[model samples]
Target: MGSNIVFSANNNEEVMVLPVVPEIEVNKPQNNEQFETLNNGTINLIGDEGLRTFSIASIFPSQKYSWLKHGSVAEPFKYVDFFNKWRAKKVPLRVVTSRPDGREWFNMPCVIDSFTFKQLRNGDIEYTLDMAEYRFIGGV
Candidate 1:
């Protein structure tokens, strides 16, 4: 008996490769029409009806008192003095401004010092308003 060996040299095998995934395409608004269409659906009413809802306004007096805070280091005192003036006039005081991205100096502990939780509640506000114009008053 002789040993038998088998060998194949013409064998062909195909290697498969996966296709690449396409990048995401974001369709940004090109004009006001496209912009308004996306935003209009979210709005319900306009004019007086919208105005009837809770309204918040920011007032910059012509002259800030000497006791008021001027720079960022003393901004908290400005908020405090504003509320104090409102209290003196017997008017409710509420604060509404753009939502802060992170821990702002105005939102720090030292800035809100002495104001109790309940008193702080009176300074609550709904949403920040988008003002078309703003004015800062200098010396009294």
Candidate 2:
């Protein structure tokens, strides 16, 4: 689905934009033994490859265009930019990925510095908090 997303600038200008907001609702297991307490500061970032791929393909349907398309090539990088912007806004970031082990090599250091990248390694999700070295504006 498409949406008329809006962004407001400090100059009082509003820019109408289209953003892909994939909605995924998963029902948690009802068993109390499967429950885990989430800290208030924790921000779960799950990377759904299927959803990402679907959104990317939806934005640019032509396979021949590949990354040669105007904004299509640079679209993925915006996620990194978003991480930095959110950090500047004092939002805590925590990454959660279903990606298999060893895919962390594709990440850029600039974006990696803003969040605790968590992904499955050997059938378990592990976390690295190199980003937490800096102090957030809020008590994150």
Question: Candidate 1 — number of clashing residue pairs?
Answer: 0
User: Which candidate wins on lDDT?
Assistant: 2
Residue 75 of model 1, lDDT score:
32
lDDT of prediction 2? 0.28
User: In candidate 2, what are the lDDT values of residues 1-140, reduced to their tens digit?
Assistant: 22222222222232212132123222222222233356655444453332111111123121323323232222333433454465576533332222224233121111124244333333222222233212234653
Residue 102 alpha-carbon offset, candidate 2, angstroms: 14
Tens digits of per-residue lDDT for model 1 on 1-140?
11111111112111111011112122222222222356565443332211111212222223433532222122333433544443455432222222124221111000111232122233322121121111123841
Ten-residue segment with the worst summed lDDT in candidate 1?
104-113
Candidate 1 clashing pairs? none
Given candidate 1, what's the lDDT at residue 61? Answer: 25
